[model samples]
Target: MDNVSWWAVASALAAGCLGLSVPGLLATLPLRLRPLPRLALAAPASLALIGCVGVIDGLLHLRFHWSHVLIAAAVIAAVLWPIREKRPLWSCPRLSALLPVTASAVSSVAFALVLLHQVPSFDLFSQSYDNLFHLNATQSILETGNASSLQLRTLINTDRTLSTYPAGWHTAAAMICQITGVSIGVAFNALAIAVVSVAWLPGIAWLTSLVVPQRQRTAGLCASLLLGTAFGFFPYALLIWGVLYPTFLAYALFPSGLALAMLLAHVWLPRWAPAVSDQVRPWAWNDRWMLLGLAAVWWLGAFFTHPRSLVSMVLLIVPLVLWICARAIAVAWKAGGARRRRMLWWLGGAFAFVSVAAVAAILVVFRVFHVASRPVGDHLNGPQAQAVQTVWDGLWQVLTQNALVGLGLDMTGSLIILAVVVLTGLVIALRRADLRWMVVAYALIAVLFALAAGSNSDMTKILTGLWYKDRYRLSALLPLLGVPLATLAVLRIAALTRWPRVVALGSATIVAASGWAGLWAPVGAAAAHEYRLENVKTTDFVDSRQIAFMQQVADVVPADQLLLGDPWDGSGLSWLYADRRPVFPHLNGQWDPDRLLIAQHLDQIESDPAVCTALRHLNVHYLLVSTGEFDGGDPSGNKFAAIDAAVSQGLFTPVLSDGESALLRIDQCS
Candidate 1:
């Protein structure tokens, strides 16, 4: 069969397997329970198993041995075994009551996957180092037959190993790769789509169900759909998936953490039932245990999958823990002796389980990887730096110009609006003023975390300190907490108006529309591709003329020779020539003083005659410079002008020049 047919078969197989497994997993839950609740419990466990297996295989390089398979089976059995011990079944309100929530969850996942698949895949560029490290680690684990001493890096110039990414995401990708025998690209794509559908969507749905009243369930469902769609389907989501696939995988686990936190919060509060109401009694011990287990899975998944997201989770958890503590205290204060004792038991059990799981995750990350909490520095350049400068401007632009109409159907603006609407709705719905105050506090924490992490400073230091900054804006996941509250607020507002239902429905519609518009922009008919990366082909697409000239130089250079150039140019060229490793590829967050020294010396060798002579002694093959691109408009004003001048004055021979980039070969003394 042709490659196309092979890929088609693989795609079909992946879809079929996931479709069967997901539904079966979901079906295992008590049928009487709300769909969201079942998903909230099941999705995280499934994703955790998937991720753990992947990290083991990808980072540890463990083979798909029978032992590994047995471990996975054991994990699955452990999670599912509890379901077999049947308890008295309680009746829920109705399946019809959950249709809106279920539909919204399903629709959000479906839309995200469809949109993601429709986009063309791009060659992994600068971020491929992370992928390579993960791949290498997983391979090493398999080869050595040792999981415990699975060092992530082979070469360590820095204090941290180059492969020191969180093990969870790599393991998940590795497992998927092992199962499918597909390339990393396909494995990541499958995992990314599944992570959202299974973990994120369901988590959002469950959070909404727990908080929103039955009467206002539709609005809550709508709000969730708005937030999930806006956040999960943004352009950045696609960009991250295309370039930094693992980070995208980590992002998939983000929603699950929030869901777990919210689930725990609900258990603590046990919303009051009216005297006349016939709703079931507050959640039981078994239910609380189940939520705790699910929470544990999410928290573990967050830490393991992406260290960066772990930072974000740390930021979120502080307020969450405080809220839980306050609720427990309030319950104990108001309750009679026996009831107070029971509340204490519940609080202790929940906190102990959560605390243990958190500590275990920390030990795994720190002890296993030997990662230290260090101060931030130069690694803070590029998109993050740009993001810091533009964040305030972007926020202002969204609020003033497009608050009502919304910045038409693009991911970034839509996400900002979704966060705003959800927060507004939640604030309005607070039955207790204290709850409102807690929400405000959490929101403040999230904003502060985002500002610090995304700023022009070291994200790692901020994240190491905060822990929650790891996932960046994943605190946006908390906006989901406000979803239920917002629904009630809408209903309450509508009640004061003549056409209550219309006002509520209309308001929801406007919010959803605005969100959808912001995330899914209309592409021009003549646009080359629907997705940004798809517009350019990997085989040939030059963003800069200098890049094209550099490629030409690469064509003439021998495979074994080293060519030095600027950091940005070197990165793109290295990716293009599969066999070549640039003297310094753009730092992959693993660089230290030594690596920095190497990079600086390499730069010096490329530009300075004395340095070039020394580099030749060390066996440097060629020096490449793009005088035109480097100099604003005049080649003479370029940073490499001295090198160009020296080469002209018989210091080196210019072998090639396309009026853009130039290649110089140093003459050796015989």
Candidate 2:
């Protein structure tokens, strides 16, 4: 890492500390939490606060300067100094108490290493499709001094109205870029890798701890480790897929928000219906209002980070909420002592019903009315051949052949095996009518994702819109809930047998390692095929020549001029690397008259006067033509044909040329 990168890391650290301390200072909630879990809270908390800054900057167009960053740091320090004035900086805990924290730290480091091993370096952004938008958005935030999702519409179509895209991750990256003078790509990549690998593990572990009692801290550890290695589609596949950075950041923080919600509900349920209080254990923290306030804040953080995360978290928690309400109502109906008491209980039930109904109505409105206008595109509407093939190759191979493509071991077979274990745990938990709601909630989410990835197109589309229709996005939620249940199942199985403790621990460890390896199998196989990363088929995810060509384009094209080219062919990347704008930066339906004109006339620029007129009107001063055909179509030949025609007709002046790419400036027309 260079100096700027180091500074970015330092800034992340400071943000982490502030994130942890701010919540502590405000709620003193960590007083009830273990030391390590408190540290985990800092990561999301810092990101949330930084996200808030980004949101404000974007909405208000506030410049993110070094002074602003320094001021933010100073405020954090001021808050921390007073809070730590009387209390010890670190909590003193027994050695056994440190196991969960140690496991979490180890898992984070391991996950970071795994990601680094796969991604290798942050020199280039992931070749995932959405990175085009994310990188440009980061650049826009850096230039405009705010992470405005709406402002980024310029990349799509200059004429479109502001849209409600979440820019929290981009905003944080912009902050890093502003302060460190590193490239936006560097800042974005760095923050993403750090949060996902380092912060994400601890966050998951802490969430697991929330549901897993103090006695089963080992289960939490196991779950955290499992998260580090298992479910390649989630944390790893996301890196290679859309590389959905905002969703990744939000997902990292989601569990913490969930933990907070669970805590809030635990506290709230007792108050709303006292009979259920006997069933639910009392939280050590007495400040129910404070906890609720903190939970709400955490939820806001998730919302700002990514609306998908908030939606998913809400979906996961809805069952738990309903179950709690039902228990409360049941308790109220069962109360037979006094008329006044029964009336009060009924009143509490009514209040719960009204509150739940109101929240549900608001969410429904947000989804149906508010989000209907946004441009998510119907890309995943049809039954995708690739989805079916992926399922066949991944799950089928594991089941029938007893092997995954990359891993030499038969590790993937455990997906079925552990799935059974999870189901068994859920059944037992439900039979006892204990805290099985948590297991059920996650299971429902998992099933929803599976259904979204199902063979049927229409059902998949509807389910997919619920999660942006990305299986990887939906898959991210599974390990957080599944691992803990798996841990509990393992513990239960161990208790049933007279087997030595070592046998049980060893078995769990093997399962964790195998599950991790299994998940990596399909991802590794898919990487070479889908992305052309190492295995280099004719498909173009990215290449050295493209990178070199982009660098050349950056060198020749002025930052101020707009370059017209096919975004699908990687020409749009100049906006991120070269600070040049593209007429059509992406193919995701950001339509405008100018964009339509450019697209229609792109192949006719040299042959027709109208094409030149439209180009001039759009102020497209330059053309960037890449020689490669990509996902959209074979734009390489047509674009070059247009370029060649322009040069022949003396309509364009050649500025720079490489073998497969050329930069041409449109000549002044009479």
What's the CA error at residue 545 for candidate 2, in Å? Answer: 1.3
lDDT string for model 2 (60-85, tens) is 66875434544554566565454342
lDDT of 1 by residue, 523-592 (tens): 1110113223222223222234544565576576777665654432233244333324444333233554
In candidate 2, residue 644 scores what lDDT? 34
Query: What is residue 175's positional error in candidate 1, in angstroms?
Result: 5.0
Error of 2 at 274 (Å): 13
TM-score of each: 0.60, 0.78
- How many clashing pairs in candidate 2? 3
The best candidate by lDDT is: 2
Q: Cα-based RMSD of the predictions, in order?
A: 9.2, 6.2
